[model samples]
Target chain A: MTALTLHAPILLVALPLLGAFATPLVGKLGKGARNTLIGLIVLAVAGLAAMLAIDVFGSGGIPTVYELGGGTFTFPLSGGQVPVRILFEVDGMSAFMGLITALIALTGAFFSFSYWKERSGGNLYFSLFLMLIAGVFGMVLTGDMFNFFVFLEITSIAAASMVGFRVWLKQSQEAGFKVMAMYTLSGLFVLLAIGLLYGQYGHLNIAVLARSIQGSLTDMVALGLLLTGLAMKAGAVPMHMWAPDAYGESPAPMSAVLVVNSQASLYGLFRILFTLFGASISTGTVGWILIVLALLTIFVGVTMALIQSDLKRLVAFGAVSQIGYMLLGVGVGMAVIATRPEYGLVAMQGGIFHMINDAACVGLLFFASGVVIRAAGTRDLNQMGGLGHRMKWTSIFFAIGAVALAGVPPFNGFASKFLIYEAAFKLNPFLAVLAVLSSIMLLAVFVKAFQAAFLGPRSNTSAHVSDPSLGMMLPMAALVLVVIVFGLFPGFFVDHIVTPAAKALWLGRDAYINAVLGG
Target chain B: MNIGNLPFIVAALLVVLGLYTFLFKRNLIKLVIGITLIETGVNLFLVTLGYRTGGISPIYTFAPEAQQMVLPTPQALTLTSIVIGLATTALLLSFAVFVHRHYGTLDVRKVKELKG
Candidate 1:
């Protein structure tokens, strides 16, 4: 147990990476061997993530730091003034994000098992999938800025390839190109920011930089680049032009994984805001900036979703909107952080809790939609009627996902959004009103989709539609179960998991810095 | 203008030019070139960050004692960025090829099949 805990952080990232490369070689054996190998790798990753989360959360939010190249874990490296060796820092927040990634990756892998049965290049597909997962894990766990950029690029390349994996489809190619271009542009923005910071501080270690940051004009410039780049990746409005294309065009299971990838970038954004530049910047200005972006994202995402005739695109827009809720929640928290307002902690908890809830809700929706698209042979909602007649299990799963995502009561979405709304109301009633209106609009949008695709008279196109095999159904069912369980026990989860994760960001900065640099 | 800051000025100009080409040019291949240009600018900036006017290479094995050495980290960072840039550019160009094959044109304006 000690050994596993000691190595779990690195193992969480390295195992999937190694498995990705080993997949093609294992593919030479047989499909059964390949599937089993991928399944085992995902399961092992989930187990490690779970163990690490338990360790971090149980330790009362002290981060677990692992040094590479077998040196002492403390910073200032024996005789050096600045820490140069690479390290992995797993705090409550990182562990929380890891658990979310593991859950979605596990389900996405399982769902892809049957989804990819008829598809060629299954080996390559799983390989890229594993690479994407590894990249996300690394992004959330790495303690260095350059390492984060490298992981960001890895996710970008793997994800873009997967988006265009259907080389035969013209739309897929177009989406792939646009997404890759945007991802590359954003990544360069990040690299340039890292360069600026390194030129000033002569160190790439995040904790060291955070300790040394003085918020000069150069620092603010770097901040602007980091913010714009990560927000673009996270699908914030005005910079979110590529999201619908990437999400709507990719394979269904890949869409769910892509949502998690965006959230990983979102994680990076928060890390920068709270931990790295926490004390240096004017929190109120930056917090209000996030709030404004959140409002725009929510309004635009829902309204656009309402008009989308393509079922996946509608869900994709909905996914983008959910990013707004998280931003609003965390933005409220950040706005009030300096004052230490009572509601600030609550708001942070809401935002952090919403992340896992959104993952499950969105993942279920995408998986269910994948099944629908597969059965009906079309993505057009108008052309996909009466699927509920035959696809009984999928209909139930889709309904659960839709209701949960729309923030309906007694589902996970409402539980988290309730916290956000209450806190936002306390902060400013106007913000709460806008959030509620958007939630209502989101509900209406999903309702229209549900009616158009599943609740109508049988069309000729859906005559052959039926429930997918247990393989795919199980993953969706698992997510449905998560939605219900999280909804029913929101307080339990908030106290145990979400609070620690939130506090790690809201109030754990000193511990984080000290863990690396020592007191 | 200060001579020492010239590299910085050139890097910023390169980035601006790349953005101009990326935003203004219609050809998909040209867009790829634009991206590469931006990448080159960033790489140059990273390399320049570590340069010291009279410092020797960072290799300590054969160096004269008690002399200044340019920072090795930024150079290392530049090399990694270049490799990553190559991969990104290769991927972008391949996607362009596929797009041209399917759409029969490389014009960005022509690839409107995905928009609302």
Candidate 2:
């Protein structure tokens, strides 16, 4: 027991991974038994994560670094440096992500209990869900670049497959194809960049590579490739075309999982920009390039969302726009680092804070859309009217989600966006003005969503549209409550959690190496 | 152990050719071929990074008194990378089969049901 508890972090990953393999065998026990077994395991994992988060952050903050393979340092390079072989560093940021991931997975698994169809390959769904959890957890925990890429592949492949789980539908298959193509291609670019870094410095660990490699042309090339690859995964504009189709095609529970997954990519983007490259490398054209991308991403994402008629696609596109907001915050931080590095801290804090808020709010929005879709049997706005009359709980939840998404005060979105707006304005007034424009547009758009789906007169088949099962409504209700609670009390999330994270990011090179490789 | 040898140049040329195939190939299989070529190029680069003048393999059993040992880390990483490439190639090919089954076509432009 003592030995098992000592390796708790590793067990967090190995548990789901082993569950993914063991699920098939467990499924053979009996019908409907697989999901129950997987749920029990994941619930335990979630509980473990919550406990770990509490332990890590109970005092100020705890940074636990583990050296893999017997904890003995093994030098794998000619440079005589201790090569990091499968290192897992658990800090506040990872602990936070771990908590959210486990919570969402637990809620999602609980929700999926009644959601999966007997004929819908339920066993496979459970298997993939476990694998997805493993991948996300690994992504947050792993310190080595190669392992990060491997986890990225795992998450992407599982997601693409799940996106097209309904293979009979041509659109699902097409969405799957497009997603697979983009994700794999982006992964190839990331691999090339990793190779570049490895060639320059004979190391694959992010911490060691950052220390050994400096701001050379090779570093720039590597950064560009890595940024482009990660941007594609983050669904930044131009590379974002695959997202709506993929999200729209996936099951609602799966879509909720995907919302967290996309946010996970944003986490990766943040880690790479602030954590991997540090402040010095983050300045100059790199910062400006991200700024341009963020500006366009917000403008393009919101505008595109405004024009969408399909409910799910509209929410998916709204996600793209929201990603713009986070990117904007990060870009502003990058731009500020060289001049007034203090402002960079605020910008990064706001950006990282928004990442958490956006995940919760947008995740709820997608979950609500899923409920509406399942109830209405159609995703088109023209067909969904007067649902508020019958599906009272859903209507209330959807409204809460929409309000939060639009950055309304006293809601979670408003708190994060407030900080983001302040940071952007402090850096560049022009950026603040543009962000305000996008926020106003976001408000108008979600208002349209509320009006069209809830407030309007009953369409022809509106009477038939009923609320989803209690299982589905419950998870979304919890998320909505969280949104409200976080909004009302933003300090708990921002000050204790996000501020330290952003400050850790702001320490520039020292923090970067310390976070990944430890002091 | 010449600084600029023909094998190195040939390896570089092979990589370029592979990239060209990736960019210009219309068939899905050929694109996979291009990716494989790119992986080979990367692996070659790793091996080349380890290459030292007159240095032999890092195997201690064959050359116990060897003063120069070619970097063994890159060789191990390249081996892992080669395995990853194999897995990717296999997954890509299997996806191609599925694509063929559904679309009945492999022409990149023809798979256009997902266009805007």
Candidate 3:
């Protein structure tokens, strides 16, 4: 209702933008002071974003659109009117994503305080970190497709550069190259698709395109292109080759960001499917494609993780598998849209709920792996042994994360996976059965990681491993607490954030068209 | 002969050609060139979308001349897309330089430290 709340979306990017530049300038004044300031800035932005998300949820299903300069009006032309302005629209979906992105970014930035010190170019790290956060904010908040492409590039370049933080290492550089190539190629696909859409409709605004499109061959082509490109970003199988190596090579803090980044891509896919192409496209075909892809992603990702000797690579593969679960939920939702319209809501709820939990669980796993790498100075499970007694906090955190990822009871991961199974089973028990099989593989893989890294005899040849600094430990601890809290009280988050997001996604097409083109 | 259908087919062929060159090329610089060519095809298609039979540029210096304007939105979007393409091309080229310095070769096949 107020001006401050109206500009909430832009503030998500600007706060970080200002901080990225401020960190180095402030660092010039002192060493410790700069980190403290950066941490404070991250916490501030995250807190503000949380507040805005709450406001949006309380406002019911009405989406808030804020024009870049101010004052929104319709431009009359002949017999029609169109909106010509840069706008930020915060609906249930965008706010939910904003909350997830800001929360994870806050934790990562705070964790980096002690984790990145004594390394040269800390300022550079913070700058790139903020830019990455800003890019995500832009991606979720912007309504324009071309602008979305730009933000995707920003996220890609910053992430790829960060993946090779250890620029001197040959493995790191190679991993960086693979990730960069894949991300750029994906972006190019998205750009081409957007161009195709633009040529057909003469509108790049997503909301407008949604209304004007009505089940044409061009629409189908655009849909295919969009799905392929977004699938690559989400690390879907046949296009997910870069995920494991990139996650393995990046620093822990950045790896956490990458997990969340891929989740954002999934969210983008959901937005396109439900919000952009919902009316024009049939759910049956889209749902089948997603279900098959999700199945392959889970089966392949976990089987590959099982054979991995490197701890970071193992965690990376785990991330790929977790993405499958989220897709399963979304795919189930898509399948039920026409056949069982009454159960559509439940399927969507399951999918969106899984999205939030998977971000937390997979993010925690990557962070813990970073801690393991930091302590042992290697990610090889064979080189690691009983550091459980020495690094008690790290071990416990890793165990919590591992259990959550395996979808055990009394974890946030289980709550969502249970919902997904119920919904997916109702639609097709076979999908539900495959999901269970995938879950078992994930459990076995993590148990192996624990046994190899924490339960074996302590290797004297390995360096003396200790827990990360308190600054780093604090974020992991916070994540552990969230997993426990959300696991215990899943309904609160589900009812408030995920439920409304599902509604907006499933039935808000007309509202979207009205906001963009003004009939 | 409808003029609208012509540009679309041409653009599609150019994109296919660009992809072929990119996939087959061994040199990093040549790969980048392939990407640029593909972008050019996309951009040209975008500009052509705004075209009308007798429409002029969207810019109207005189108030009375506004009725003859072509659709300006696609043109604006294309300009933005082109600029983005330029930035990507620049970044990829610099990355190629980094690759050259590290591996002592511009061939992507020679870079194997990341392969399974």
**Chain B TM-scores of the candidates:** 0.96, 0.85, 0.88
Q: Which digits, one per residue and each the tens of the lDDT, describe model 3 over residues A1-519?
A: 676786788888788878777878888887678877877778877876887788888988777776667565632112356546666777788888888898789888887777787778787788778878888888888877777887888888878877865666677776776687678777877877787787777677778777677778877888888898888888998678889888888887788788778877787788888888885788988998999999899889999999999998898898898888878888878887877877667878877887777777777887888777777777789887887767888889988988887789899988888888888888889988988888888899999998877776767743477787887888889999889998999988889888888888888766666665554
lDDT (0 to 1) per candidate:
0.93, 0.76, 0.80
**Best to worst by DockQ, what's the order?**
1, 3, 2
Residue-level lDDT of model 3, residues B12-106, one tens digit each, is: 78888888878999888888887877877787778777888677677767636446667887788788778877766776676677777788898
> How does model 3 score by TM-score?
0.94
Per-candidate interface DockQ score:
0.89, 0.35, 0.44
lDDT of 1 by residue, A58-132 (tens): 998888888777555444233335666888888899999999999999999999999999889999899999999
Measured by DockQ, the strongest candidate is 1
Docking class of 3: acceptable
Q: What share of the true interface contacts does each candidate keep?
A: 0.84, 0.12, 0.26
TM-score of chain A of each: 0.98, 0.93, 0.96
- Provide TM-scores for the models: 0.98, 0.91, 0.94
Arranged by TM-score with the best first, the candidates are: 1, 3, 2
In CAPRI terms, model 2 is classed as acceptable
lDDT of prediction 3: 0.80
- Which window of ten consecutive residues has the lowest lDDT sum in model 1 chain A? A72-81
